[model samples]
Target: MLLKSITPRESEKIIKIDRFVFTTFANIEALEYELSLGIKKIEAINTNYYLKIGGNEERIAFEAKIYLEYLEHFSGLVEKIKAREPLSLSTLESTKIRKILIDSFSAKTKDWLLDSSRNATYYTKEFSIGGVVL
Candidate 1:
């Protein structure tokens, strides 16, 4: 141990601590920062990525992705969901509820895709009282 190089175990532990990093944005600048950071990591280490491609679809896809990741990373989540318990505080914290509640920063690429797509807008059950689309 001449220079005391970081062990794979230590590096992995550090990565595990940041296994799920999230950044919310009030504007495009904030989103850009996260994008840059995420891009940098791809070269430094092989990593799983969850880049929300657009603002409109952010809410639509956010919860499902986070939930899937949550289920994959922690078996306790699966057990809790199976047991039919009220979501735990920690689990609630882990969910992507902000996307459902907030208007996230719009990405140009996402905006373009949504604009070009025939059915771009999210369809929330909360949006309609009846069959009428809101």
Candidate 2:
């Protein structure tokens, strides 16, 4: 007779995303603003930038991309408001901005499970009566 040995195997998956490049001047400012919110700076800033938040590089890039897109989407409207010099928002424009704020809170990725692995387990129970196994 042979007894099988139980063993558990574990692994950690790390994904390293390629550094993101800022194309537009507004995107650079957006990046700076994002960094300021967290009081963070580029880890390696030479030809490109290396950014991470809570040790997640992908999240940093993902957020920057979203901010850039948001800025691009509303740039024209923003410029129009600014062009007035006084930069006053009409009731309609104010309502639109409020809607944007509401939408921003719901922004989330479809999948955030970046890493996973299969796991195994085993259990045993021992019985004894009057200092003798039964």
lDDT of 2 by residue, 63-94 (tens): 22223222333234323323433221112112
Report, for every candidate in turn, its global Cα lDDT versus the true structure: 0.23, 0.22
Q: State how far residue 79 of model 2 sits from its true place (Å).
A: 2.5
Clashes of each: 0, 0
Model number with the top TM-score: 1
Model 1's TM-score against the true structure? 0.18
Question: Candidate 2, which segments miss by more than 4 Å at Cα?
Answer: 1-66, 85-134
Error of 1 at 95 (Å): 13
lDDT of 1 by residue, 77-97 (tens): 333334433331211224322
